[model samples]
Structure formats: structure tokens, C-alpha cells
Target chain A: MGFFTKLLETSRVKSPWIVHFDCGSCNGCDIEILACLTPIYDVERFGILNIGNPKHADILIVSGTVNHRNAKVLRNVYDQMPEPRAVIAIGACGTSGGIFREAYNVVGGVDKVIPVDVYVPGCPAKPEAIIDGVVLALGKLKEQRTAKDTDSLAAELHQAREFYANRADRQVVE
Target chain B: MSTIIPFGPQHPVLPEPLHLKITLKDEIVTDAIPMLGYVHRGLETLVSIKDLDQMVQVVERVCGICSCIHAHTYCMCVEGILGIEIPKRAEFLRIIWSELHRMHSHLLWLGLLADAFGMESLFMHCWRIRERVMDVMEATAGNRVIISINKVGGVRRDLSPDQLRWIAQVLDELERELDAIKPVLTNDYTVKKRTVGVGVLTKEQAYELGAVGPTLRGSGVAQDVRMTGYGAYKFIDFEPVVEKDGDSYARTMVRFRELYQAIDIVRQLIRKLPDGELSVKVKAAKPEGEIVCRSEQPRGELLYYVKGNGSKFLERVRIRTPTFANVPPLLAMLPGIEMADVPVVALSIDPCISCTER
Candidate 1:
């Protein structure tokens, strides 16, 4: 492996930039997520930056239940992130669809669309649990970036790059 | 030419997904239309499947910030329909939890507003104080955010004298910290620059647009549903915090003053802590009636309507949250304001989209 790739892999575990997306949650999990950034819970000490843009993020932190309408949006966000990205499903709704699982127009957990690496379970998961979940995601992120994982990783990146290139080509043709 | 700029569904200023379509004429906003339903979990419709007791848990999840009050108001509605009177001690406990919820909600709003205008230290300071309230909540009720203390007839838990004393001590410390930071919030140059003379909603406009809570109180209307005397509020003596300016600054002041009001109310409830049974044993008999219940939530007045047939499950449950009522005024206030001030102006109403769309 190249020295730069190894450097990037190790640095990712130390500092993981994450984008938080609320699919269809009661603001409970969302607030708890925000609380983690505040002075008391302050997840920043671990170098976890709450980056707003999905493209700039290394970890995707999703909260709440995924509804039918937002399912596409969630997929688009996941697709926008570069390969080796990890997803942390925070709160019960994001993990297995807590209380609103049976509701009409609800698509259950976030795993319905994208791959989730870590699951933090709570009605609205506490900030402590959320931080722990992110730390867990960082471990998965490091594993995904390892030399042994690159074979399957290269295949997924090839397909994603092709999909983007085809879409760009289509736009130019139009 | 007027161009449209869409904000949110995932903006930093908003915790929940609230989309705003702003039509701007150069630097000024010509019109603003808010589109909701991003966080709608269809909780109200779950009444058909979950029984009335289980539905409290569902209702509590409608908005996590105001979970205690949502459960409190829903239980009040069911109790009203059943005509069951709760014990005196439970009423006092309910008031204590509700006021604590109000303190944390206001502090959360204050911190967010500070963060919106780029006041990082002020945001940190506010949340620091807010943590104290959350600690008291955790020490007493077990959870930090959703206390889940409110039950059908009364409350699920009780506090000992020592715990109550610890709460009073913590509240005293909170008040001292708030005093140190009060000037920064009220008289700071940046806070004043962003909030003062912005988003002015006249009394008539606020009334016509159906604004409620601090949004209504900020407009000089002095209209608080707490004056209606539900729960233990009838026993406590208090008045709504009103500011006549009707600007963003005025709304901010209304919430700022309310933080102290909540503290005072909690103090009063603790002092007059009554002695009795915690909750009356409610029969699991199916309810048959239509009832409307109202309670003063931290954001504003929450109105809950429950229709029950002779079944364990309720037929219908509808909630009209304060944010839903306050959004129209936000739309009215958006135009004629600079594009840069839109976030603070929208936040001035303390919009909670989860509750609004629930």
C-alpha cells in the first residue's frame, strides 16, 4: 500500500468527520445527537467534526425511522460519500424502527436503504451512547480502509465511478 | 427580479427538517413559504393499534424535547374523559417535571439562537447551564431528555426530601450561573445586532396569524394558556412573561424571562409540595367520549383531542402544537427582512417541526 493511503487510514480513526441525517425521527434522537456536541458531552474532544455536507464526511450518522419519501434522499447522501465511509445508525428508530415501525408511510430502520455499521439503541439514544456509536463506526471505517479490504472496495468504487461518469455523460448528451 | 432560495430539510440552524422556500428580491426577502412533513412519523394514527396506556409512550416520542408535557397533556385528556381526580402530590410532581422541561427547552433554544448568529462561547455557556437542568432531571426521573414520569392519573415516580433538596440546590446554582451570563444574552452587541428590531410582528398580525406561546407573548398580547389553570398551575400564582416590542429581540426577551419564571414556578411547587397518594388506581375500562385537553408546553400551548369508543384503543388522537400555530406568523414576518437574518427570524418562534408535523 502507498504511504499516503496508510496515513489516511490511520488518521481516519483519530479524526472522523460525520454528517448527521434525520430521516423521519421524533426530534428526540436529533436533539440527543446535538447534545453530544455541547459542552457537557462534547464529542469534539475525539476529533469528530459535525460536517454538514455529505460529500465531505467520512462517517454517515443517521437517526430516526426512514420513510418512503426520504429513502431516496438517504440513498443519495450515502452514494455521494466516497468509498470507505461508515454509517452509524443512532436511536431505536434508525436501528429497528422503535415505536413507529408499524405506521403507514414509514420504511422502518435506515438499514432498509444503506449499510449500517453500528447501531445505538434508545427511544432517543443518549449522547453518551451516540458518542460510543461513532467511536464504533471509526473502527469499521479503519477496517474498510485496510489493504486486505481493498479488493472488494476497488470493485464497489469502480461501479460507483462508472455510475457517476454515465450520469455526467447523459447530462452532456442532453 | 426575485429569485427563490430553499433553506433546510437539513440545515444546521434547524434540528428537525423544516424546508423554507424564500423568494428574495436582491438582498431582501419578498416572500417565504414553509414546507413541513419531513419528520412526520404518523404517531397520531398509531392510536388504532396501541392502547391508550401504550399510546402515551408513542405520544411522548412525537417531539423528544417536549416528551414530558406531551405525555402529561395526553394523560390529562384521558383523565378528564374518565372524570378521575389525581392526588395532590402527583399534581405537584407533574408541575415540577413540566417546569424543568420548560427550563431545558428554553435553554436549548437560547443556545441554538446564539449558535445561529456565530456566538460560539455564548452557545457553550447556555448549554452548560442547561446541563444542570438535565442532571436534575436525570437524578430525579432517570433519563436526561424524556422523563416519562407522567402517567394516566398521576405520575410514575416520586422524589424524596433529600432528592428534592438536591434539586433546589442545583436550581440555586443554575440561577447563579444564569445571572453571570444574563448580560451577554440580553445586552451583547452581536446578539442585539442580530435580534433587535428584526422580524417585528404587530399585535394584530400575531393575532390574525394565530401565533401562540412566547411568539404571542412577545407581541404584547399576554395570552398564555397556563392562565387557564390546568394541573397544579391553578394552585401557583404567576403571570405570562410579555414584551411589547414584538421584534425578534422581544421574543428572545420573552424566552429569557421565562427561564426565570420556570425556575420560580418549580421553586413554588417544591415549597408547596403536597402530601397524598401518588396516583389513583384507574380502572382499565374502555373510555367512550370526545375530549379536548390543553396544557402550556415550554414552546407554547399544546391542544390535544382524543376520541375514545368502548375499546382499549382510542379512535382518534389529534395534537395542534404551538409551532404549527406559530409558523403562519413566521411566514408573515419573513418578507421585508434581509436574507442574512432569515435563520434567526425563523428561530425566534422556536420552531419544533417534529411536533408541528406530528
Candidate 2:
């Protein structure tokens, strides 16, 4: 278990491939994240790559507030990513709900549906903060190196969905 | 019958909310149905309750990348209805920012397109050059990308000689970097193979489907609303970009060529910019009428229709973004293409789902 945990942690720091998903973000944070990947910041230098295929990714960085219509789609995508993965929720919208928290369309925080490794808070967080959040997420990822042994992350995700489902107040999303 | 594939309000390839239900048989798409309104914040309902001035902020927020284009179109519609003449200097500045935005937007799309094709170097190089443009936007305006410099009558800010000089220097440097990439994009066998014959739209098809921007231009039609000579376009001596064949390659080349034209337009605006106040005081009177405004955004033709009552609130507002028009042609093109080429073809029209949904 110790050795397996180290393998996941080592991969988390080396080449952390990220797949970005927007639940209901205002695009401000999404663009900022893109800026970090651009030339000046070039997070790619740190082996951070924005990948398309979920099967190959190690990190799932979600931006925006997860809304009603997209709740299922978001879960499906998170499931498609290979085992030994981490979820990093970026922007205030993802963590709490930002300005749209009270809105009818929003599905509360992302943690309600998926287990989040780290939370990056900002109205629309700066690119530098995003870089730092990924680093922080990597740290959390390393700590859970033996992710396959107990499968705590998967269980956490199931509990999260159940939490949202059990809420009687919400009408739109299950 | 062809095979069917779903592209998305939740696609891995696109950043926007677009659900393209593509029907394909043996690598050809037989039919397509576009699913929209995912990002709809009920903005039109929101507009019905908000004043025209506040609507500008909301409309600008519709699409972060093309925020200025929406503001310009909305303001022009308002100005047209009131019969207000803007300052020449403000007009020039508007064109300068608009074109600079066009450059960065096209470059950003280019980078995404490169990434779609798995060309990491091309993606890196294009994004590297785009940062220079973003720096200029940040230096001039407080924000880097969403430079909220547009106002109702004219503009909200002015440029100093030092700033103008700095803008010119950076613009030239970007122009040089873009020039270096031009030949490679045009001549690269990989790019040509992936895009050249992929999404073909004929001239009549372009007009019939109401394709705007480079998607329209790539079809060999010279129909740029900028030639309508709105703002400073009338003052500057620039020709519209047109390419024949209407393939994905043609659209790609047209954007590459326009980067050069945008730089030239900015240089001319700087050299011949007039002297005057940046903006005039709006009367703040209630707008009570209907107005329609259109512009050539980086994507294509954007249409905005606004209805106002005698109160501060607008009666109704409607927006038809370019991607709406480009989708039909995309459906038409998707059939007969391999699955591997899906990402490039999907991105070819530069999907802006936030704008489309809002």
C-alpha cells in the first residue's frame, strides 16, 4: 500500500494531465485558467498539460457552478477518467457558488456531486492562483497515493451524489 | 444510413455549450440537429428589466472574447436610432481596439485549432505570440482580455503619445512574429492534410446559410460589414479578405492573412488618429423604440435587436451569434469525414457556446 501510494503521488507531480470542465462558470475563471497555459505562464513547463481524452488524464479541474442540466454529464465525465485521479475545484463558483449561488439554475457546490481534492477560491481567480491550486491539488493527490487500495475517492463521490439527492429543497437536479 | 455521433453541450473538444447530433454512415454525416440554450442566463428576460446603460455590461459579458464586438454593435444601434455622431478620435480608437481584438481572437483560435490537431509546437508558438497582444490589452486597459473601453456615443478612454508609441511598437513586434508563422501554417503538410478539404462551403451555401466572418469569406465571397464603413473603417484604406474554395484550409488561411491586415489597420489608425474627447455625455433619457445592429465579429456576422420602452428597462433584446449560422454548414460538412478529424472540423468555425447560449 505504501509503495502504491508513492506511485500515484509521483505521477501527480510529474505529468499531471488536466481535463477542464465548466458546470456553469461565467468564463472569467475559465479564461484565466487558459491564460496560465498560454506562453507567459506556460504551466506546460511543469508537465501540466490540458488534455482532451479523459481516459488518459490524472486530474479533473472543474470551473463554474455545477447546474441542474449538467449534473449527470459532469459525473459521467469524472467517471470516465482513469483510476488514481484527483479533482480540483477552481473559482468561487465551483467551491461555494459565487454570485450564482442563489440562482435557480445552479446545483450548489461541486463537492455535492464529486469528491474535491483542493479548492481554489476567487471571484474569478488569477492565473497564478490557478497554478498554485494545481500544485496544492497535487499535494492532496500524493497523500492519497494508495487510491486503488481502499477506493475512498470513489466512495466519496457516491456519497456526494447521495447527499444532493437526499436534499428535499432542490427541485431541478437529482 | 450513416453512423450517428453526439458532439455536445458537454464536448471534450469544444469549450462552449454545443450539442451537435451528427448522423453519419461510413464516415459521412447524413444529418445534424444543433442543441442550444445551455448557457442561457435568461439574459433577454434580464434585459427587459434593466436600463440600456446596464445592458451594455450584460451584453459585453455575453462572450468574454468578443465582448467588445457586442458592445460596439449595441452602442451603434443605439447611436443610429438617436442620430448621434461620434468623435473621430474615438472612432479611430474603437477600430484600433476592435482590430487588435480580432488579431488576438484569431490567434487564440489558431492555437486551439493546432492543439486539436495534436500539433503542440504550433499551439505553443501561436499562444506565445497571443500573450503579447494580451499584454498590450492589459497595459492600455485595466483588464487584460476583456478591455471594457467601449461606451455609448464613442469610447470611454484616451491614449497618450507614450501609450500610442508603446502600442505601435508591440503591434509591430506581433506582426513580425505572425509573419514568421504564416508560411508554416499555409505550407505545413499536416495542417493542409487535416483541414484543406475538410469543411467545404460553397458561395451560395455560405449566403443561404447566413455564414458570417471568415467562414463567409473563405467561401470566396467579399462580404464584410466593415466595408459598410462604420466607425473608422471608412477612414482607413483596407480591403476585405476573401479566399476561394470555402474549405477548412481556406478559412484557416483567411484568419492567418487577417492578422496581418489587423496590424496594418492599427498602424494606420495610430498614424492618422484625430484629436478630440474620447466620449460625449449621454442624455440618460429613456430609450423608447426598436433598433437592430449588426457587426462583423471575429467569428462572423453578429445580429442584435433591441426594443426599449419609455422606462429605463428594455422591452426586449435578441441576439443571433455567428456560431448559430456556422452550425448548419458544419452539419453539411461533417458527413463523409473520419472520427479522427472531428475535433479540427468542430473547432473550424470557432465555437463560442457562451455567446450562442446567452
lDDT of 2 by residue, B140-252 (tens): 87676567788888888888899999999998799789879888897899888889888788899888887788988999989888888877888889898999989888999
Error of 2 at B162 (Å): 0.8
Q: Please write out the lDDT profile of model 1 over residues A106-128, one tens digit for every residue.
A: 88899889999999998778888
Chain B TM, cand. 2: 0.96
lDDT of 2 at A80: 72
TM-score of chain B of each: 0.99, 0.96
Alpha carbon lDDT at B52, candidate 1:
80
Residue B307 of candidate 1: its Cα lDDT?
A: 89
TM-score of decoy 1: 0.95
How far off is each candidate at the interface, as Cα RMSD in Å? 5.0, 8.2
| B170-192 per-residue lDDT for model 1 (tens digits) | 98999999899999976799999
**Alpha carbon RMSD to native, model 2:** 5.1
